[model samples]
Target: MSKRLRSILTPIIAVLLGIIVGTIIMLVSGYNPVDAYTALWNGAFGDVYYTGEVIRQVTPYILAGLAVAFAFRVGLFNIGVEGQFIVGWLAAVWVGVAFDLPKVIHLPLAIIAAMVAGGLWAFIPGLLKARFRVHEVIVTIMMNYTALHTVNYIIRTKLNQGSAKTGMIHESASLRSPWLQELTTHSTMHWGIMIAIACCFIMWFLLEKTTRGFELRAVGFNQDAAHYAGMSVNKNIILSMVISGAFAGIAGAMEGLGTFGYMAVQGGFTGVGFNGIAVALLGGNTALGVFFSALLFGSLKIGALSMPLEAGVPKELVDIIIALIVFFVASSYIIRVVLDRFSKKGVK
Candidate 1:
């Protein structure tokens, strides 16, 4: 097989192996695997409404995945995407609710605030790592908690304590498209999917076509070497983190402005940021890969929510399936061995 073909086939084979294993787990657990799968399919694609919701759910995942994938590409592990996502969501919501600008100005401005907030959140850790030699993983993890609590506090102390949600956003700031609802039957899916796709293209362009992306990758691969080659490692490191966070922020904004439309004091963290890790891995941390992986994740999530109602199965089983899939995907040696065995057996 060609190297390119192998690259593609490896992941597909791994995914199939994961599903087979998951079926065994279900059978052992005394659950009907076929029924569970049927429920999952119905939940995800049974009707237009469900399919739209699946797309909507994955929209944020795509953005978050892009954020993590971008950082990984540049040799940075930005665990802080969670915090950046929260800050971005809060910031975007704040802009949407607090401002009175025309839609032309208001919508873009609110989204931009999220990008800035998320970018700045990442900038701190990036700068610290570049200048003071701090471990970015630790700093980013801490920041994630900080962002969660900070947003919670703001929601209660400043944004609103009594109300679970902030004031409704201005019409101009809303991303809802009324016309599409007629087709989807008033589903939650909005324009965010389009934005996520756009980001994928943008990510590809920036990384493959831009000089700045080259510098960032260089710093990521070898900071000392990049420095010796006249690239400012500090600048690239900071830039990479900032851009990663910015993408995460836009993701948050998409969820907030495009879907939720207001900030509610979240009782706890939303799962988007953390899920980005899996998304990054499943996507292979590439722009196009992230896009397709996001769709898979989104569908799984949407389908999971319906299992309890449709098939008397625990919703959490989805997590088990996801874990298995990720494990198989990340462990290439295991999959390669399996593939070799299959090939020898002529299992085609």
Candidate 2:
């Protein structure tokens, strides 16, 4: 089969397999799979409010997926996207609360703060990987805890109002659109979706249409060969991590500015950053693939809320299905080999 066909079929088959396995689990657990699935669909798309919520959930997933995919494209593992995301969220919220400029200027400034904070957070690990030969995974993982505690302290000391969260941001810095809320029947959807979509196009253009992207991909394929070809492998590695962190930061900004309009101290990881790894894998690390995969993930997440309410199925079942899909995607080489054998037989 052609590469394009394989790319498309792999994810489709994985999703089907996930659903099949999920159905079996539901049956064994004494629940009707059909009813659960029907409820899932209705919850995700039954009304304008649910659809808007799905889009709101998808907005951050797209950016976080891009963060993971961008790093993967450069052969880097940036596990600290969670940390960078937290810092970026805090930075954006700080700027949003502190500033009182016009909407146009204030919003951009808040976003830029988020990007810079995220990029700088990732830069430390990238620099260590490039200059000291330290493994980025360990450094980034450690940094995640550091970021969490540091941000928590900052919130308590500086931004807190006898609560765990900071004060609400100014209206100019808010991404909420009253008209959109009205259209969606008061769903939390915001203009951040536009920014996420723009980032998708930007990622596609950069990775598919630019010389810099070619260099990054070359380094990912084989660092020695890229270096032999006169590319600065170290530079590209650092640049890739920075860019990845920036994407993750923007994802966090979506939550801070658009969804919550403030920052809060969290006890643990938000899961969005970690989920991006699965999203990138399922998306085949392509921009367009990321967009669709994010939608699927978003739908599963938002729709899961109705599983218990509508069908007496536990919401955790949806998490299981998501995990199964990722597992199938990860084991796709087995599927590819099977497909190749069938193709060979047909050709004969």
Candidate 3:
């Protein structure tokens, strides 16, 4: 089979297998999978409000997915995206609360602050990786804890004046849209969806149509060969991490500026950055693929909220399904082999 076809089929088959496994689990637990899925589907799409909520959920997932996918393309495992995301959220909310400029300036400034903060946060790990041969994963993991505690400290001692959350941001920095709210029955949907879609195109164009992208991909494919070709492998590696972290920062901005008007202290991680890994994997690490995979994940997440109410099923079941889907996606080689054997049998 062609690589393109295989790429397309692999995710589709993985999703099916995941659903099948979920069905078995539901049956064993004495719940009807059909009812559970129906509730899930209805919750995600039954009302215009629900649809809007899905879009709101998808916006950040797309950017987060791009963050991971971009690093993957450059052969970097940037586990620091979670840290970058938190710093970005802090930076964006800080700017939003501190400034009172016009919407044109304030909104852009807040977003830029988020990107810069996230980029700088990731740069630490990238610089260490390139200059000191430190593993990015280890450095990034440490950075995540650092970012969490540091941001929480800043929020309580500085930004919030001992409060657990910051005050509401200025209207100028908000991404909320009255028209969109009216259209979606007052859902939390905002203009961030436009920004997310625009970023998708940006990622695609940068990765697929630019010279710098070629160098990054070359470095990813083979660092020694890229160095032999006189490419600045170290520079590309650092650049890729910065760009990837920038995407993650924008995702945090969506939450700060769009979903919530204020920032709150977190008891735990939001899981968005980690979910981005699954999204990137399911998307085959492509821009279009990430877009669709984010939508799927968003639907499942939003829809799962209704399972308990409508189907008497626990919401955690959705997590299991998602985990299975990721497992199947990660094991694509096995699926490919099975497909090859099945095709051979058909040809015979």
Clashes per model (N, Cα, C within 3 A)? 0, 0, 0
Worst window of 10 by summed lDDT in candidate 1: 1-10
Q: Pairing residues by index, what is the TM-score of model 3?
A: 0.98
Please provide, for model 1 over 1-348, each residue's C-alpha lDDT reduced to its tens digit, 9 standing for 90 to 100. 344555667767767777899889889999898999899999999999999899888888999999998888878899999999999998998999888999899998988999999999999999998899899999999999899998988888887836766777777888888986668899988888888899999999998899988887887788889999999988888888999999999999987887888888777778899899888887888888888888888898899888998888897888888888888888966766766776668755
Which residue pairs of candidate 2 clash? none
Model 2 stretches astray by more than 4 angstroms: none
Q: Write the per-residue lDDT of candidate 3 for residues 95-173, one digit (tens) a residue.
A: 9999899999999999999999999998988899899989999999899889989988888888774469998899999
Residue 297 Cα positional deviation in candidate 3, in Å, after optimal superposition: 0.6
**What lDDT score belongs to each candidate, Candidate 1 first?**
0.87, 0.94, 0.94
Q: After TM-score superposition, what is the CA distance of residue 63 in candidate 2 from its true location, in Å?
A: 0.4
| Model 3 clashing-pair count | 0
Candidate number with the higher lDDT (1 or 2): 2
lDDT of 1 at 37: 89
Model 2 C-alpha lDDT per residue in residues 1-348, reported as the tens digit of each score: 787898899999999999999999999999999989989999999999999999999999999999999999889988888898899999999999998999999999999999999999999999999899899999999999999999999999999978888999999999999999999999999999999989999998998899999999999999999999999999999999999999999998999999999988898889888988888989999899999999999999999999999999999999999999999999999888887888789899
Candidate 3 lDDT (Cα, 0 to 1): 0.94
